[model samples]
Target: ILIDGALQNLDFSSGSVEFHNLVIERELNQKVMGGTEDEIYIFYMRFRRGIRVGIRLSKKILLIQLEIDSGFRNGTLGLLGTFNDNQNDEFVLPNGTVFISGASQTDQNLHLYGLHWRTQEISSLFKYDGTQSWSSINNLTFVPLFFNPNLTAFIPNATIRRYAQDICYGEGLNDPTPEQRKPCYFDFSVTFDADIANDTEKTLKTIDTAKKTL
Candidate 1:
């Protein structure tokens, strides 16, 4: 990852290190600026003015949460959407197409919103193995999500909603709220993997506790 201007190799390292402006602050007490917890790596950055970013990375997920000052309100665009304190115009496309508010987020509309914002991965910040290229995987008429309505047209006998709900809400985890468990439902429904949702749940909990420190 690019911290300030230098590149960092955080793939295997876990200890505290300070090299120039790059600082890896381990999770200790409540003053953690950023560090690693288990296999998850947390990185926090506070730029000039009032722009803050918290990044949590694991093998299965990458969460980048942005915290900006109110001065830049309505001054940004793209996948973050129009931040004018109005939820109605959240999904504005590059060509000025908007999935207007009050329209239920169906599988089609959600795919439209997601696919519109994907850019060509010309370059990457980190090194990895056996990664698929955008062109190799991104087909013109392909969608990664299957639990929603679009999949039913092809598979008439598909039944995933009840199992997904049971794993997400009925697994006896009393800590995460309904909002927090929403990711688990979607993840389980998409991949049909019960263990993959742990990444989302852990990332959310860590963000909740470390938000104040960031």
Candidate 2:
């Protein structure tokens, strides 16, 4: 999913862009892959700048794999969010899966392709900025935005809250009381520095046009 108004041009002369603070989460229905009916969810959030350049592709891929279970095959794809003023193109994968992809100056939008009954299903991908405003690519409904409490299977609730608060407020800080703290918001940002200068604009326009027909 691409976030609106999150795109920016960098001064890097190497034809590469850097993204910071990207949060990617995926929820896979286990039944689709011959597993239990429960959903297998994975989330990745980067606090520092993440390299989107060519040479670091391997490292990035490794980072993604570390967060998710490797037993789930064909689920290795990662989501990209960006900011573009115009609508973007709808991508058709080799497996007959199709979905729209785009970016904007402040929002990131994505509609992920899934498999159901051997056919492709598209999930609504949404984005929220630092302000916590949300937007979706289509009229797609999403699961709850909050983290899955089950992620910390054996961890206690107090420990989870402490970790969450530390990550949200900053490290090396005392925990705050319930009244003094608020739920943490997941923020994401993206940058594209491809040689194609108008990629962002073109993608947005394409997405807008496609939306009318639906």
Candidate 3:
């Protein structure tokens, strides 16, 4: 069976069909200004097998990629993971791909979105690791440029911000008293760009202002 572009709920009885492979893809584009367009594509896949009637599981490969194009500059980013089962009972794949034992289930949920901005460019990418909820991984911003009198089209400075969030839940500690468990959240942000025309400061300030208002 094939599912496309949405979430699906499925249940199977024992000795039903077996899951072979799973694939996911997302593509997005953003037009900044003056006919310059930035495009992003992300692809991921999981390969698994069942062993000993749910006593052991095996995974082959996991991969992800990001491609960006903005008329003048183009770049690509990619990630790959391969699992080697030596003696461990369970293992978690790099890049947040999880492998579980003793559970016989499969699910697929995918989402895609596109946005256009005239004054500034904005783009975001998110993924759910199955261990926790979904969260954004990459965010980009593009700044406008103007031709200087030196007969050169000076590229205005811009900042590319990346963030990752993780949540951990604990049941309770040995306090001997009644207590509630809450999820611990971890979030961090990093900015990357070169300083040109003082545009980096301006763009960073704009982001800060927007966050304060929200």
Candidate with the greatest TM-score versus the true structure: 1
Candidate closer to the true structure by TM-score (higher is better), 2 or 3: 2
Q: Score every model by TM-score.
A: 0.56, 0.20, 0.18
Q: Give one digit per residue, the lDDT tens place, for model 3 in 78-172.
A: 11112333222222332334343234211111111111211121322333344533223224442322212221111122111111111111123
Which portions of model 3 miss their true places by more than 4 Å?
A: 1-21, 31-35, 44-206
lDDT of 3 at 121: 18
Question: Any runs in candidate 1 off by more than 4 Å, and if so which?
Answer: 2-39, 120-142, 149-165, 171-182, 198-214
| Model 2: lDDT to the true structure | 0.34
Q: How many clashes in candidate 1?
A: 0
| Clashes within 3 Å, all models in order | 0, 30, 0
* Candidate 1 lDDT by residue in tens digits, 148-208: 3332332244355444444555543332344456566566555556566555555566787
Write out the backbone clash pairs for model 3. Answer: none
